[model samples]
Target: MMDPHDDVELSDLEDDAFIPSTSRAKSLKGKSPNRFLRWLPPRMRAFLENMSRIRLVIITVIVFILLLVFISYWNGRLKDVSIPKQSLALSKELARNLSNTAIPEYVLTYAPLVFLDSEDEFYPSDMAAHVSNAHPTMNFNPVKDAPEGLTLDNLNDLNDLGGDSIYLTSTTLLTNLPNYLHGQKPDKKTLQTENAVSCVIALANKEDGILDAFYIYFYTFNDGPRALGHQVGNHLGDWEHNMIRFKNGEPQAIWYSQHEYGAAFTYDAVNKIGKRPIGFSAKGSHANYAVSGAHDLHELDDEIPAHIVFDQTSQGPLWDPTLSAYYYTYSSTNNKFEPANDKTPVNYLYFEGQWGDQEYLDGVEGQEEFHGFHKWTSGPQGPIFKHLDRKDVCLPRDGGCIIKESL
Candidate 1:
């Protein structure tokens, strides 16, 4: 036995026996990196493998936060789409009619100025003249406000205590004021005056010739509402217009200006006398309303707008050309229309400058270079007088526009 054991070395004798080694078993049980984590750092890979649930929760939370931020930003830029029922119905009809109506159709072969001479074209002139004369008698002496003897003949002399100009012209205020005592507030007897600014002579093309496409212009001195203390955009002047589009001696569409944008309705949808459509201007903003409660899309204070309903019992100041002075020029040769006759109150068509002072801060978010109820940069431009097919005739900017496609 001793001889046989000696022939086999001590290491051979140990391998033949069954040996238990803890270190060797542990090394064989250790895990290797899977294909997904092969590129990661060794320590990071080990951490991720141990804390997979924690990492997944953190990623989900980060993604949710990013989604919330995106939603908030999206809603901040969204515009209001609330339109009244009658307005909506009229808008739909306009879309339907526009589909059948071909653009650039010359419908008016003759001048449409003849329509203005008839009673059907506008409201009664005597009534408008009565409204112009109806105002509260001067109560407060404005000598301190207007040191220049308060002639009040010019709009420039009507600055308030804060130096902000006002447009509330009364019979006693603007009529070469015998005294300087126009009050600040309006009473039950006081009636606001609406002025007829200008008119547009548009033509639409037809198979035979051209047709009547008249756009009548009206304006108010106080654009902002009395509420907000006239804080938003209490400018001195605001211009609102209504467009009557005609085809083959028949009224086709009526466009009303409401702030920066407006709506077009089929002629049948509107209340009209022959070819002229009725328009109601709100009290402060002087925005055109097709029907009662018909308001602008962006009006924050809807109630502030003149609740002027245009009907038999309730009527807005229908633009009476006889009571209000006007100036216009149209050249068929050049196909150009412009404000003319310097005798009119505002010879500003050629001014190409702002009407009011720029007193507000610059670079403000919405206040920058924008008209508001308080401060205004410039008076509105005259209505566009070119054919609808012309490149320059755009919506709201031209006071009216034609729909070439579905709105």
Candidate 2:
């Protein structure tokens, strides 16, 4: 016999050898949940994983739309408001009618004054330092003897004598003009100029009799840098003003502008130690602070941590309030101070020119960039019309007097 059972066992062994070892091994399971998802319940993990990413995108879009609408509402407010036209007309008429009269001596004797650096020799300390360092040979004040033939008639021609600009201190003449000029022309290197700074008188009043309020405005011009320190963009002409408000012939408030907006100090608010308001014009910025170190963007410290502009010395120019000043109605048609028969100088306001050398771009190394785009480069727009009609008077809306009316 061939042994059929043995042959059957042999056939089974051959079949097992032909099968791969991998096939005999157990099958591997799928990957487990990530570490983050492992902490959640299995059901919760599944729910989160099923969320549509599209929903996130939709929510983001909705939030952006809401933000856009919020911005639009605020921007619209700036454009919607209209200036009161009747007020403007009233102011113009008031300016023209008062042209003939002089600023009352009593009003000038009592009103407070806002002091500025004299265009010539009497510069603030910082400016004096710069002038001494930069132009050592040049005499800041060169006149000892007052030049004759200087008048409002020939005042506009002051620049013809090498003066960079003129200030109208009064419609008449400044008797003290000689004091502000160069010292007797003793030096050949001195800054050459005939100081012909003048002034115009105007009184803004609400009515003819028993005046409720009056305004006295002054004008000045600067030949260079215009600001305190050696800031660039020094210009040829700068016109600035200080306005005083009188109620019942008493000085009620003083307005000293820095750039466009300034502080309005009530008669009681300022330090009466000097018998007038004491204001400090910042060293370089020239923004007048009610007190030393009190400065802000609009000269209002409504925001905390205001921009504190420091003066070179806490003790600065102190002006005499009792000094004579005037008020005048403006005649817009003739560009004249009221009382047109009074000789008016050439309408220097009409000729707009660059007040100084071109704006400077190069700043000293390791210092803030002093580009030419400063206010000095624009030259000063002489005392423009400001309204005393409302305590909230604002010219160009964002600027000018912002004193809230006492209701």
Task: Mark the 10 consecutive residues where model 2 has the least summed lDDT.
Answer: 129-138
25-88 per-residue lDDT for model 2 (tens digits): 4332234566798799989988876664567888899999999877654532212222135433
RMSD for each model, in Å, please? 17.1, 18.3
Q: After superposition, how far is residue 92 of candidate 1 from its true place, in Å?
A: 36
Assess each prediction's global lDDT (C-alpha) against the native: 0.38, 0.38
Candidate 1, run of 10 with poorest lDDT: 110-119
Query: Model 2: how far is 111 from its true place, Å?
Result: 2.3
For residues 1-407, what per-residue lDDT tens digits would candidate 1 score against the true structure?
Answer: 37754566778668657554777657756565677887899998988887997888899999999998776545322122222354335434434543343322222211111111111212212112322432211222222343332221332333333222222333432213222221111111212112322333334333443233444443323334333222355432244555555555655566666666566776566654333345555554555555543243344234434443211111332332211223343345554444333333332222221232233344543343323333333334333322334332236343445543212
